[model samples]
Target: MGSTSKMKVLESLGPLLVACLGILGCTQAVTLEVKERNSTCIKAELSALLFITYTTFNSTSNVSTSLPDSTSVDAASSSCGAAGRPPWLVAVFGSGHALGLSFATNGSFYSVTNLTLQYNLSDTSLFPQSNGSGVVTVVSSSVGIWAPINTTYRCASPTTIRAGGAAVTFSAMRLEAYMPGNDLSPAESVCTADQTTTTAPPTTTTTAAPAPTPPGTPETGVFSVTNSSGTVCLLAKMGLQLNVSYVSQSQNKTVQELVNVNPNLTVTSGSCGGTTASLVLTQQTTTLNFTFSMNSTTSKYHLSGINLLANWSDMTAPFSASNTSLDYLRSTLGRSYMCNTEQTLLVVPAFSLNTFRLQVQPFGVTASQFAAAEECQLDQDQMLIPIIVGAALAGLVLIILIAYLIGRKRSHAGYQTI
Candidate 1:
């Protein structure tokens, strides 16, 4: 925090750039198999074992101040040391506006050329976790700026992450290009009004909001979708992870698996006709004309569906919406939540978003409910039953005629009599 300390970090910059292998020598080029790049910006894959998600990075975005995996730390004499170069990222979790970011290289303050390019949350309070003491120099031929490596920002455009954090990508972290001597700060992902951190709700004296109606509590294979209420079809994802209150209409009362591709993309598939369910996920997205149609193995019947628009934000109104666990979430993290800005603290007043997405059949029984509904309807069609019965009767008469023609002739009359 003081220049004496900062100067030590600045002293380590420049003239010591390492191009050889890291001390641990873990800098192997990653071998990625089955990397499915689509025209879409993001893609995901889900199977019985491991789940994978991949997003294309047309550009670089901000790293929020909270969560992990955002910042790198512990620089010792070289960038190759695990303790020298920080390697962390940000997650959409935690309790407040400011994320904890700290990185120390060789226990000395430092000045480095560049910090990672980031889609910084719009927070005035956040400061670089870097030690701004090094007498470092930066050289970016494109930007045409060559100052002591005391810079914090990489000349990255902000347009890379206009939608939100759930859809950001990265090209590289070249913070050293400019500031060569500063101690690195811990990278953090700050949750703004748009991003949210989760905390357990305070116990209320008032009766807990009646547990969300589970999928198939009072009934089986029943589900509901809400958006001022229409045919309730179109939507991709607004976080549909099953929660404890989730009701199962076909199998057990809980879900087995969930796949969230993005804020607007998700997939939840399961086998449910009894107590235990095996599930799969195909696609859930904010893309228009998204369809979800699958068959239920129980009755061996057919079912299908579609939504008009892509799934939108989960915010319903006045800071409320559906979430991964079927619990209602207000847009804002909540009041009394602290936001650290340059040593200042703040709290949210209210929250909201564009749209919300819920299940058609409780938390884990959509396909089965659909199949059951069809089966129940088929059973009720007694009038059609009689018509089908009549058709069978006509077929029986035809079968009798064919048999007589094949076996009985006038010459065989005596044999028939016998």
Candidate 2:
């Protein structure tokens, strides 16, 4: 309690207090409302983290920030119009970012036609090649929301919007256009990522003993195929596993075998063409050939085909499969498709493959790097299940506590004096 000790303690606590305040100020909910002719037309509330990545001096740098962080939005800059101009709303933020949403209405229904985000890269440290600003068309000519006029749209999960090198991700968002009142109502149509699919618990069944463990840990690495100019045209990072079913000569029954495509497999041959790219992985007597194709119209690419050939000592002959007409992995240019859960693909009836922690970008990559990623449905489902379960468990606990209190009160009703 001495004066000197008190001063030292205060000094030590000052930094911690500042750090706590900084963390608290990092994120805040931003609400944008548009009014026309004294009637609120659009209302949106978003509370999410935003990240930016750009190239500077041939190297890519990333900046992470949350929306409405220390920046204010002017009410005068947010406007709505609908007369002959196909109902649109634009909100400008003090950070030199603008969000625009265009709406289209038929006689019965209204839909969002386009969503755009204009960002300014004025900070030289964050964006080295800082020009004035740039525009990223998030969704163009796509029906983002289609509901009856006055319903709200809600998406609780993270949604990624990508365009070329720039991308924006939004989470915990709620929006309403042509609102019935000034406030946002319950959402009528939910985003697919927010929907939950209830799967029945698995049933018990008698089974044989588990098979032996596969060769080694699932190998994970990046595989790329470069073009004639030595530019990487296809890049994929994944852990691969091959499953083969063959007749066991000793047992005279079909037996399942698992093989891990480890990092020891070398790239024996590969080629990148104008419309297609191929990579071949070879190890001992096993070979895997991956073929990818691009769709110019959509500016997207996919793993269109695959071929597998393997020679096992236990099998009578080499197993060969050439699945040319297939569409397994797909993503847009400058973006990758990521799936952390294991994904199974059947090349043939008896032969199948699995991919884990897979992320692939087929084209428009810079500095051998991966751009933004579109998570696979399985990954989204995995994320959603935990939230749903947690909510359910919390509700059950609340119900049990309420029931216990009611039961206790009822039991004490017969007691005269306590």
Runs with alpha carbons beyond 4 Å of true place in candidate 1: 1-58, 67-399, 411-418
Considering every candidate listed, which one attains the maximal TM-score?
2
Q: Evaluate model 2: give its lDDT.
A: 0.64
Per residue, candidate 2 scores C-alpha lDDT tens digits across 294-393 of: 7888887887766776656676444656565578778887788899899998888888889889998767778888889989999999999999999999
lDDT of 1 by residue, 1-418 (tens): 3324333332332112111122222122211111112211111110000001112134222222212332222222112213223322111222222111112121111111111222222222332332222221111101111112233323221111111112112211223221223333234211123234565355445533333343321111212231222232221122222211122333223322222223222222222222111122222322111112223343221112111111222322111111111111111111111111111001111211211222222223322232112212223464578899999999999999988887777547656442
Candidate 1 matches the true fold with a TM-score of 0.18
The global Cα lDDT (0 to 1) of model 1 is: 0.23
